[model samples]
Target: MKAVRLEEIEQLFLREVERPVPGPDDLLVRVEASGICGTDRHLLHGEFPSTPPVTLGHEFSGIVEAVGSAVLGFRPGMRVTGDPNIVCGHCVHCHAGRINLCQNLRAIGIHRDGALADYVIVPQKQAHELPLSLKPDYGAFCEPLACCLHGIDVAGIKAGSSVVVLGGGVIGLLTVQLARLAGATRVVLVTRQASKRRLAEEIGATASFDPTAGDAAAGIAGPDGLLPGGADVVIECAGVAETMEEMPRLARPGGTLVVLGVMAKGEKIQIEPFDILFRELRILGSFINPFVHRRAADLIISGAIKVEPLITRRVSLEEVPEVIRNPARPGEVKVLFMPSA
Candidate 1:
């Protein structure tokens, strides 16, 4: 089997490795499609904490090539999306139903061999069934959509609400659609990329903004700006220092700010605590998909969330290392690796 392995920090290569055999409670999925995430780049550059000498693809879905004896309700030939995050059920957070906060968290691609290969093992608990009829490339989006779903869940978007999405990447674009589905009447996407800005509006954003053109905070929240008095909810999905620093200012007094972006570890950004205190704003840090993977799968399967537009390109596993080594191409949203290609 060929697997894209991160031998160590700043080292990544597609190496031939022995195929993995599934454990009693696991499923051996033949990798079909896996999305290259920003976290993959983070892992490569040692910006994020990840156990090296492991395969590096977390957002993936594939066909079940084989199943463990203990696996139930699933069989060979089933199409499924894997929830890469594994939690210890006995952890305090897990007991409290906060599994994403589990103290002993081990994630596929980050800590274990993942779907960036010919085969990857998925615990039965982490596999979600997808219709065989679903597009193979679309299945790869389930993981990212799941993470976005968690962000939407915590944002508390309501009917007639207004939302400002910072960044026009896949996460931000997905968040825009979810916000609209959650009943936000007005959704504004903030990004400098003209192409992504155009795509955002076409998808669901009521409007879009170019931060490089003028003052983003004032342009979105100024008395004469789009939202006028700021948005009901502001989500920072750019995962950049500039967006992180400007996130709070885009929200109205007493509104919410959800940090759904994955910034590198040890990254710092200046923020004003006084504004949050004075406005009594609600600020939340949404981690990985906790209990929303199923909903994300359903949304994707049902075509409730449009993912086809978010896919920028599809590459082979051989091209993955180079793709991850460089920055995402201009206006690129999501790139998937077709293992069988």
Candidate 2:
């Protein structure tokens, strides 16, 4: 089996390795499609903490080639998406139902061998079933959708609410659709990319704007701006410092702001604590999918969230290392690695 291995920080390659056998509580899945995430680049550049000498794909799904004897409700030939994050059930966070904050978090792609190869191991607890009738590539999006679902859950969007999604990448685009589904009457997407801006509106954004053209904050929040007094909820999905600084500004006084994007470790951003204090704003940090994987899968299977538009390209395992190393191409939303391609 050939796997895309992160031998160490700044070192990645496609190497031939022995196939893995499943544990008693695990399933051996043949890699079908895996989405290349920003975190993959972070792991490559050592921006995100990860155990090296492991496969580097977390947003992945595939057909079950074999199942462990202890596994139930699943069998070979089934399609499943893996929730890569594995939390210790005994941890304080887990006991409190905050498993995403588990102290002993060991993600499959980050901490163990993952689905960037011919075969990867998934514990029964992390496996979510998908319909076999669904598109093969669509399954790869379940993991990302799960993460976005958590952000939406934390944002607490309501009917007739307004939302501003910063950045037009996969996360932002998905967030836009979810916001609308969550009953936000007005959804505005801010991004410099003209293509992505157009796509955002095409999907669900009531409007889209180019942040580079003028003062993004004022343009959106000014009296004559789109939202006028500002949106009811502002989500920072860009993970950049500028957007981080602008998140609070885009939300109306006493409104909510959710930071769902992944910023590199040690990255710093300047923020005004006075504004938050004066306005009584609510700020939240949403982590990975905690208990939303199943809902994400159901959404994907039911076509409640559109993912076909988000997939930008598909490459084989041999091409994954290069794709992960370079920055995303302009207008590129998501790229999937098909080990069998």
Worst 10-residue lDDT window for candidate 2 reads 332-341
**For residues 1-341, what per-residue lDDT tens digits would candidate 2 score against the true structure?**
99999999999999999999998999999888999999999999998999999998899889999888899998999999999999999988899999999999999999999988888999999999888899889999999999999999999999999999999999999999999999999999999999999899889999998988898778888898999988899999988888998898888998999999989999999888999999989999999999999999999999999999898999988898999989999999999998556
Alpha-carbon runs more than 4 Å astray in model 2: none
Distance (Å) between predicted and true CA of 156, model 2?
A: 0.7
Clashing residue pairs, candidate 2? none
lDDT of 2 at 340: 55
Q: Residues 1-341, candidate 1: write the lDDT tens digits.
A: 99999999999999999999998999999988999999999999999989999999999999998998898999999999999999999989999999999999999999999888888999999999999899998999999999999999999999999999998999999999999999999999999999999999989999999999999889989999999989999999999999998988888999999999989999899988899999999999999999999999999999999999998989998999999999999999999999655
List candidate 1 stretches off by more than 4 Å. Answer: none
lDDT of each: 0.94, 0.92
For candidate 2, report its TM-score.
Answer: 0.99
If candidate 1 were superposed on the true structure by all CA atoms, what would the RMSD be? 0.8
